[model samples]
Target: MGSLLDNSLQIISNTTGKSLFVRLWPLSTAPKGIVYIVHELGGHCLLYDVIAARFLEAGYTVASHDQYGHGLSSGTRLHTSNYQTYVADTLQCLEEVKCQYQDTDNVLLFGHGVGGLLAALLAAQNPGFVKGLILHGPIFKFLEEHASTVNVCWYLSYVLPLAYSPVNGTDPALLITDKDQRMKYARDPFIWHEGPRLSTIHAVTTAMGDLEQVEEPLSCPTLIQCGQDDQLLNKTNLTAWSKRCSKTTKLLFYEGAKHYLHMDTPECTIKVLDEMVKFCDVVRSEAASDTDDAVGSEAASDTDDAVGSEAASDTDDAVGSEAGSDTADD
Candidate 1:
């Protein structure tokens, strides 16, 4: 079993005119593919070390970058009023990984909560870059059935972009039924308690609107897994999102789980990872088969050319020998 430190690798993205924080966990055998993991809201990449390790163990090179204004990244903490900056930063990070790991057999994106929303947006925009998607508790609709509150926030953010307000009446403990996990998250220093900025909320709302209007079918394979008891999203929204997706989508609903399924029920999460890796393995095998066929065809053509040359030489020698024999006989 690899330790947490063993899987840690520093990554930086200079595409956005600034260096951003990223971490990678390379599989022991260098992995069959690469996966870009995006953390949930108010969480850092390091908090996902344990989860990343599961992917590493399953022979995947897992990498995650902290969004600007969060974690170890060099930016204004708790200051991103607009969430588009976060999405743009994530795109830069993905580009860096694609460049650095050019030989990766496959590329998959895994995201949670707001990160999942960003992942969906990226997948919607750049459909060809990612081979597949794994979304856990994606924020398709914010505040669940409480549309009134969401509308109020949306209006406020549009009018006052700089407004800040603490999310009221949310019990952190209710996020997960697992007491141990809840306590750990509560005490984790990387977990932020501050509410989102007005701009961030606006960005989220805008993203949701865009997501709702996504009518074009995605060609890539997708997996949408959510906890049955997640408070942030409802089953109706999840079902609607999955139905709108192309037929190449898989949905998993975990009973009695919470938003942070990876932390609350790791075994189930690992099972899902295994399924994703299996899908990637099949894709890689097909690609390898195609390459081998191309090489084989070229080799066969070369062999045929060589054989034809040898046959021509033999014919020439036979004709010369017959002529010489005829001359001798004459």
Candidate 2:
């Protein structure tokens, strides 16, 4: 955990003219890169304030926005027509970040839960948008015990899309093991305490299903963090999906931790932050190296052109001198 710091929030309009609550934690000096966070389902960007500040301290500019239908964003609470809306909104946010921090080209994505799925999809589909990804307990596939719930959501999606059904393991107490952290989540007024709308569940599950069928792996570097004891997802399935989705993916599992690894314990949270910082540093260095190599190649080409031009000038001068001498002798 990092020291508590001040941050600012603003309201930005999405492509569809929907207002989204955007926040930025900028560094006093130039940042190594920019980290854009995507919040989980039913969660707000403010929930990631601590982690964002930590990145700020590590010399990174952090930016995030509450997705449509969640937090201060304009929409029905915990609802969206489809998962693509979230992806489009997130892409808009990335564009906005680019405009905001034009100096830094290394933009890393940090996503949690459903947001992780969105980040993975974007990184896979759009390779040049981000430098790396840090996924905290992303839900690519549901556990076997939750298959029935997923089936129900899919069925209701065709008929009663707005119907509400209790989703297991959504309660703050169940997701967060620490009492203080649990209460913090429970008491957050912006959080949706009721069951998620059927359409929202359907959108997420449909996206997951699509990812499961993808044959191509993500092109960028990816780091996945999970709690070994998380009750919300199947570890085996998550591992398989990570291997399938990213050829350069790294996995880190916290022992005895639940869904919320950051809220588990101070030690665990620090370790998570450390790993994230290290990964970002490596990616930033590699990106900088690539830029340098390109510049060097261009410089070498210019030098070669200059040398060739000088040699041509010398040859022309020598030919003119020889002609003048021959004319004098004649």
Candidate 3:
């Protein structure tokens, strides 16, 4: 148990003026590449440590940072006072990791729930930065439309800004089937059960709006996994969204699984990870081949130019040597 607990660590780091907490799990062997795992709304990085450990076991470095206004991150908990700031903060984290891991060219972005939404936006913004994407039950839009009454309440809270209101219509039991897991989640010191800020709801809505208009074709390979019984986004929308992607995208739906498919079906999740690793390997091989072809073309061009120059020089030398020999013989 002591050795098991030693594998995880809670790291507090500063990013964009906020104290952001992250969970880092390094593999025993050198990592193939770094994976940036993003958590759901109101969820901390530690919640996904088990998932990260699986990746670590597969010889990949896993890192997850709590989003602003959530977990150990220093900001308004449950409030979306500045949604764009959250996006920008995520971008900063990516840049920081990219700088830190200069040797590792393969970077995979994994996001679950709302984190999946942000991951998609980030990938859409910078196509070349992410090698592949793993979206687990992404919250593209709310299951039910916000009624006018809720909107009015949200507006009032926005005016008040600090006023707290209970988020309605969320089934706590749906998150996890295990009673111990539910109890642990509720009693966790870093977890926040309070309703999200009015500003956050507005920000999510706005982000959804932007996601709808994202016409830029993503170049990275993507895998989107959703539970068939997901109470969040239904299957129809998930199918539609998957079709919008231009790159190689595979969507898998597990029957009888809920929103938290990772916890529900760990074996399936691991299988998906293996598939991703294989896909990345193929991409790397193709990229290396392309580079080799370009180098070979340049080398052949250089060799042809050198042969022409050598031939011309040989002709001149032959003429000079023959003249000298003839004059000497005369």
Candidate 4:
């Protein structure tokens, strides 16, 4: 186990002037990298405690923030004016974390549910900046039931954007197979029980559409994890989205897992964490290799330049000596 340093909380304002609740878990020793956790919809940063602890033990500094309209952040619960607001808020939070921990430039993004979508967008927008992406049950396309309501929600947003309807929420049982875990999730005060507002639904759908139109493939390493038993998403969609990314994209499905793989049963949760740690290690190794390759290429280029210059100088001297000898013979 790695030694823990003092954990701290910070409040940063988003573009809309809402204060985002930021949490930093720094390691006592030099960290291998940084993992910025992005929570699912209706969930807060605290929901990532288990995963964050594991990352901390694995020598990573965990940085997270309660997004606008979630947890301790200032906004309407489970509501956002636009999907871009979430992206903007997350980008700002990441920048602040990067600024604070300038020593550790290597960073990975761990996002869950809709947060996964946000992370993917950020990684795509800023190519090569993020080393890797770990998406836990990312919601690329809504379940059949939710997709069916898209048209209705878009129409209703103008009239009833603030309406709290049952369709906007999910069954807790579908989220976790373990009864205890499901109960705990339902009971968590920080997690909003109320469904997302109609306006929020519109925002999410718009964002999903935009994601499909992203022409450039995500260049960084991406891990797309899904549960075989997840009722909220379809494996086909995840697979299709992975194809849009670079060859480094990995799609893994847990046999008996559900939506919240990180918070699933002990056996399943352990497997998820272990896989995540392994992925991070692999990404770190690849990054180191790339750096070494770059340095080697630069050195080779310099050596070639030096050798070419020396040969040119020698040839010039030989010609000058021959010319002087010829003149002396004359």
Candidate 5:
């Protein structure tokens, strides 16, 4: 993580005046595309730098940020009034990335766990916001051990919605098998360590209902990856959600991997990252195909000069900046 932070690290705030920490990587040359990533619950931008670096090597200018209360971003720590607030915050973050990249299309969304949930919701709610999406081990539900206590949480939420739940918390060993990685995860200062907040849990509960009723049938290219051995949530929910997508959708289940697919064993991580890069290639190919078809349509029309201007505009819209692309201030 430290190694990947070699360039363009920033602490920028959102519209709420809540300081938002973002890790952005602009390619050495003009990029073929751009990607916006959201982190898992309790995850910070630094933890995702490895994945961001992979995007850089793949020739896409990359950007990602910590959500309010989760990382260096300012706000309550891992607590919010409603889950929709997260969705809204993510939408704002996406807008900032688009403005910075001067991109309306050619942007893809990547999320892990809760980040995946928010990304999925954002894409479903707003069509054409992203060209594609890639989700890694998204949490569809809490662990079974945690499930038995939901009713109590739901009832208690009314009394003290912002209170933290008294649970022993997760065992890092369960998150990843490698001892060193487990130790690193345990010691990671940015990870939210203090047991769950009732407000946060309540928001998760409500998000379940919201996701169930979204009905948008995701319009973009989508990819969902889950671990067969994941103790947190089964693939059933993930499968059900994939069915709602209107366009291309692919789901893969890893045999021996755990919840943190990104930080799994070297072999697993290699496979996962390779597959993800390949997925991006498909998106790039599709975008290129669209541009070619647009140019061909214009050429076929009778008006030669008008067609040239239209083709040029289409090319610029897909690749170059329009006018005012925003960048972080100090």
Candidate 6:
């Protein structure tokens, strides 16, 4: 039972018969709000300890559950039936946390990588469930770079749904620009590196397609941040999301960071974290407003004009400097 100074770790089980190891960082008084942390492919709830502590120190209660197939949870390691499975698990964990904490309706969902995809789709699918959505290096284009390989994998899913196969090997360095961070990831005993199963590839493709098809404005305020030097995803994905999402979407490309911007050193990581905290503050104010529509409209316009403009004009510079600095080490 690992615990924080003001937190406790607990186990939660859902209907799927999976027991997720969930942790909490609680506030002494009523929390400002709740933030649910959803991690990426190789990540678990515990791996987000830093962010959870940071949010706790900032007056928000934080809770996170290890995905069914990952971390301390029981399942076929690093596998899931489809995207909905992950979403269901995440939603269940949130409810359990809320119940445990006696929290109110105000909620913020934070996701990274594939977890980002799950969070965005969940908020999109369930309107008003979350007041804020934060996606760091969201997976928009999953394995499209290897379309031929993915097609073969998708076809194989019909016969070998449970069989595991490898995606192209990813460099650990791509996750963070810091040498010590990369080394820590390499040594992390809990990391899952077997890559995606066929079903997951198929689910990823389908979910991304579904996200692209939704033309309606996002129901909740969203902030999407991707490192410009990210090796896991590209700027094309950024452009697609900027265009695909509502005016409420705030987008940013960190100048010299990599895919795991949250894990990057303070110079780069703090900037993105600061932006996220600011965006959440804006949404919390909106939630407190007497008129929802007016605030939403103004916020959407400001996001569109500010983020959309910066995304276009600054990405090139961010990309341009990638060659000279240690950024390319990712």
Best by TM-score: 4
Best by lDDT, which number? 4
What TM-score should be assigned to candidate 3? 0.81
lDDT of each: 0.73, 0.83, 0.72, 0.85, 0.77, 0.78
TM per model? 0.79, 0.90, 0.81, 0.95, 0.85, 0.82
Model 4 steric clash pairs = none
What TM-score does candidate 5 get on C-alpha atoms?
A: 0.85
What stretches of model 2 exceed 4 Å from their correct place? Answer: 1-7, 245-247, 312-330
After superposition, the stretches of candidate 4 with alpha carbons farther than 4 Å from their true spots are 1-7
- What is candidate 4's lDDT per residue for 208-229, written digit by digit as tens? 8888888865888988888999
Query: Candidate 3: deviation at residue 203, Å?
Result: 0.8
lDDT of 4: 0.85
Among residues 3 or more apart in sequence or in different chains, the pairs in candidate 2 whose N, CA or C atoms overlap within 3 Å are: none
* Candidate 5 residue-wise lDDT, 1-330, digit = tens: 222225567666566677777778877676777788888877787887777888889888788888888888888888876888778877776676666556436888998887888888888888887889999887756666676687677778888977887642456766775667788889998998776678778787778777778776588998888777777765766787788778989999888887788788888887888888899889889988999999998877757778899999998886644343432321
Cα lDDT tens digits for candidate 6, 1-330: 333323477776777777887778878778778899998875788888777777777778888888888888878777665778888888877877777556467799998988888888888888878899998888877545777887888889888876775664346776788888888877777777667788777887788888777785367778889888887775676576666665478788888788888789878877777777778778888787835888889999999999989998798777778765766586
In candidate 1, position 131 carries an lDDT of: 78
- Candidate 3 worst ten-residue window by lDDT: 1-10
Residue pairs that clash (backbone atoms under 3 angstroms), model 5 = none
User: How do all the candidates rank in terms of lDDT, highest first?
Assistant: 4, 2, 6, 5, 1, 3
Prediction 2 global C-alpha lDDT:
0.83
Model 3 Cα shift for residue 127 (angstroms): 1.9
> Per-residue lDDT for 3-83 in model 3, tens only?
212444444445445676655676656667778888888788888766676677767777777887788777778777655
For model 5, the superposed segments whose C-alpha errors exceed 4 Å read: 1-7, 143-145, 166-169, 302-330
